[model samples]
Target: MEDQFFELMCEKSSSESANTSGRTEEFLDSSANTVDISENEEERDKMTNFLQVIESYTDQEFRRNFRLNSSTARMLIDRYNTSSFYTNKEHGGLPKVGASKEIYILLSYMANTNTFREIANLFNMSKSSAWRILRRVVEWLLSIGHEYIQWPSASKVQDNMRKFKAMKNIPNFVGCIDCSHINIKAPVSNKHAYFKRKQFYSPQLQVVVDADKMFIDVFAGEPGSLHDSRILRRSSIYEKATDDVESKFPFNSFLLGDTAYGNSQGLISAFRENGFLTPA
Candidate 1:
């Protein structure tokens, strides 16, 4: 009887050891699975947060924040994805951020005066990433700008002229030309050259717009101190007008300008009052 009791105790001890071993293995497997699941959830949450921030804004809010409509923003993203610069295999780095998100970053930077650090925090990216996106998007946009902004075709010019006539009874008026100042930081060199009458440093942006208020031509980068007429004379439109006025101003079309620009061929300026003018 004593021998049988000892044998039974040994069997119980062995069974307990096996059961402990099995439990240890199961615990390790469960811990490893939990870790993997936790990591996946963390990553997924980051992406979801980014998307939620963007989608939470209404259409009007999106435009107000980004300075572009959602549809236009989507179109830009579609174009960016198909561009060769975005698709080149030679460039290597960590996996790229999505074009849609990068575009939002770029537009945010452009639409606001926020620094890279601020923009990065807003978009959940590094400052370096925000700067890189801005530079790349700007370069791509510059490459394609001419395709979208150009001198109107003859038919389009005629349509613009009719629209202008109907709107303000201005005969053969195709566009209105004006110059506005774009504020800029004072340059290290020639700081005074950019100083404008508004008590700030800036560069000039001269533009011509049709009756629909769409830009047909743009000239920029002149010093703010220069007069509007001087800037116009330095523009390509002036050069073209000087060479062959008929080619650009076909059908006797002309641009309307302010008193500052004065009267010239292919352009008409408003009369400046000197206290000696009749109503007619």
Candidate 2:
């Protein structure tokens, strides 16, 4: 996924260089005037159809399709609006699509698991347009979203003790560790590495979530065929756990995990008993 985003960014940079005149503020303003009134109405109706579909969804339906509740989705859009490239009026290039709506389009691509063509049809945009919107929004999210996430500090670990104990009688536990596969298009080269035993091609996404189910850390880009333990060992978070964090808060503070992650010094795994696993 990261590589794909970089490739898209490179493509965008090249395209921008070739179309300097088309992107000028005067050209953008006059381009709208060049279209006939009927064409303008048609474009408006297309956007309206897109909005109508979004509005018709109930709360659960909306969350199912977009993978975020309405409020969170709106909040993300508000954050995106802070970016100079995403704001509508001040930008010159193309007539801007809705900041909120374009975000919804990208989320639908990610959450609803649709192809670019399907999303384009749903949003009343061209296939290339949908792809461009997704690439841009993803770039922005990757840049800004990580600022809000931090690993549990020593005090934070201490504070969550009671809540962790109440949930499962576990003491001093800070977070859960797990890995899942994110499906992706087959790469042009080295296609064999991503194929898993389960007969799927994907990239492994390792995540650590605190008791509240918020992601504290994430590591991606490993091939799906790799073992969980190997991915964890290769991740920077694993290095932090062993080299830095373990000595400072050694007692009762550990990460909970499954058998796939193996027994490690700073991590705990469930015990295997008669094919069932007991909690660490």
Candidate 3:
């Protein structure tokens, strides 16, 4: 543009050059002004190109990705704008931080780490908005997950254990007890406290699963601070003295656990009570 302006100025001033020095001053001013104009025009062209790229997104593709049906999208957004936490009995209307409806829908598919950004891109929502919705849905799920997911009783556990007898050297089992871990972010302070003896940063989960590996009953959620031994001692399953209770189980059935569990009354594991689990 500067070059073009200079060329035009030169062409216009060529005839004037024969007149006087005043013409040179005027021409220089005109050339300088022309350069600014050309620069502004170039900038405008660049802006136009940028805007074109932004606008190039196909409406069809966008609508599909964003789940952007006008009525549904507006309703969901409005619900988020007005609605509060589903778990909060006290606080009525809208989740405290992340309860946007669009995000909640995304979480229904979040069996894995599939990201909020991907969801946002698909849903045509802001990443932050998608993230908030996901969070709230998770909280909501957690809040009610327990009531729906229940702990089975002793007889149920006993009945399932009989099938394991089919496996050689396995018998009289009610359930298998073990520890699982829940993933979490490291806290800023006392990092070691959350860390398990396994040297991992996860919450320890104590579960009692039947022979088929279906969860019979569980100790539920607990921090990693305690050891497997202490966790069992404190668990309601342990306190119930399930093994000692006289039940109608054939041979007064029992359960199994790792060597981590020492001998307890009626609770049978090869680690603690050998012959109870040994094959017929």
Model 2 lDDT tens row, 1-280: 1112111111122222223222222222332244222222222223438677787888788877766677677677788888865856534465668888788887776676676556666787666577657756765665553444456667777766567888989787788889988665554446688889988776677777777776666666677899999989987677878788765345558888997777776688876676565554
lDDT of 1 by residue, 1-280 (tens): 1011001001112333243234323322333333222212222112326656776889888878876677777777898989865643433565557778777877776677666556666766655556657656655655555554567788998999899889988789889999988666565556598798889876677778777776667666667899999999987778777787888899999899999997887899988899988977
TM-score leader: 1
Q: Which pairs of residues clash in candidate 2, taking residues 3 or more apart in a chain or in different chains?
A: none
lDDT of each: 0.67, 0.64, 0.46
lDDT of 3: 0.46
Poorest 10 consecutive residues by lDDT, candidate 1: 2-11
The 10 consecutive residues of candidate 2 with the worst lDDT sum are 2-11
Better of 2 and 3 by lDDT: 2
- Looking at model 3, the pairs that clash are 65-122, 66-123, 66-124, 83-93, 83-94, 84-93, 84-94, 84-95, 174-254
Cα TM-score per model: 0.78, 0.76, 0.50
CA RMSD of each candidate after superposition: 25.8, 10.2, 26.9
